[model samples]
Target: MSNDHGDEPHELRVSKIRSGTVIDHVRGGQALNVLAILGIDGSEGEEVSIGMNVPSDRLARKDIVKVEGRELSQDEVDVLSLIAPDATINIVRDYEVVEKHRVERPDIVEGVLSCPNRNCITTGDEPVTSGFEVLEEAVRCSYCGTIVREEIASLIDTA
Candidate 1:
């Protein structure tokens, strides 16, 4: 079925992966962030493909990331939820989608984000891991109660 744009029917521009994860419907402009979260530098010998600002019926514009020969860990997916909550994860094997689901924001996020508060224990030399309560518009530090509402990309602890 052709759309009103008269453009050719949308197709997967990237080749299918033998086995890996395909993150689709990512918020437009956030595909690079997803790649960052995945720690894929494109130098690790894995086939990685990214499509940004792609057309989407649900989001109008979206991004997609295809990683060949690897699957995302739960921690990685959790971090993704913070950046692209509405994104869908597709587990592809043998060029077929075996599993598909949308990413969900967990009630508690840990270790992935550094508390913005300087005095927060997470920032201190102590061994406390950062913890936050997932809120609708912000994440509240469980230690210092500091609410992080913006610039989440900067606050993410990729270590």
Candidate 2:
């Protein structure tokens, strides 16, 4: 709806993906992080589309990511949950949505995130994978009891 100034809202039109994944309702500004988690920098030769700060009724604003000709792996989805918990994954095949689901944070996250504690076993050459217990507002390192509260994107291990 327009305000008293009589300015009409413009519509956003994004092309549909024929056979790939469409992530919608990304927490407004986390689309880039999602791309990073997928290791997609637009240099891997895939058609990647992103819409940031789009109007949304549920979130007031949201972001959307569309990747053509590729499906999201479980690991990628897991990482996305940490950044955009309310995001939804849409599998499009032949320009039709074949599947749709919301991203869920796993109880146990491993390898995707690096523990903030430098003294943790995962940080040294102990050959232990980084592990964390997913909490409501933060993730706790399973080995060192260090809690990560912010800069989650920087801590994501895209390798």
**TM-score for each candidate, following the candidate numbering:** 0.89, 0.89
Model 2: CA > 4 A from native: 1-12
Q: RMSD per prediction, one decimal? A: 2.3, 3.5
**Residue-level lDDT tens digits of model 2 in 22-87:** 999998888888887888887779898888898887899999999999999888888788889999
Residues 22-135, model 1: lDDT tens digits: 999999999888887877776777788888898888999999899988989998898889889899999999989999999999899888888878989899899998998989
The alpha-carbon root-mean-square deviation between model 1 and the true structure, to one decimal in Å, is: 2.3
Using TM-score as the measure, the top candidate is 1
| Error at 14, model 1, angstroms | 2.5
